[model samples]
Target: MVEYALMLAIIVGIGWLIYNQTQLSDKINSVFNNAGNLMNDAASKSAKPPTT
Candidate 1:
């Protein structure tokens, strides 16, 4: 009985960690995408010819 309880606790902990990581992963992906967009915009502006 004790062994079974320990196994259950370990499984639950792993599941909770995975769920939290999934949420965090989404946030991290958003940050990276926003950074990429900003970089692209800067590059495009710099590539244009300057107006006299």
Candidate 2:
């Protein structure tokens, strides 16, 4: 009855939280990955000797 409904609601809320967290983590990972790649490219370019 009411208990069943409560349990269902709880389960749904937990599932939503997990789904949201996963999406957020994926976005964070991509941002950091892009930043790391950009930094690496800059570093490599700077290490080379200047050309006339």
The candidate maximizing TM-score is: 1
- The C-alpha lDDT values of all candidates are 0.95, 0.95
RMSD of each: 6.2, 7.1
Per-candidate count of clashing residue pairs (backbone under 3 Å) = 0, 0
Residue 37 lDDT in model 1?
100
Off by over 4 Å in 2: 1-22
Over 9-43, each residue of candidate 2 has an lDDT whose tens digit, in order, gives 99999988997978977888999999999999999
Task: After the best TM-score superposition of candidate 1, give how far the Cα of residue 2 lies from its true spot, in angstroms.
Answer: 22
State every prediction's TM-score relative to the real structure.
Answer: 0.59, 0.58
- Candidate 2: residue 43 lDDT (0-100): 100
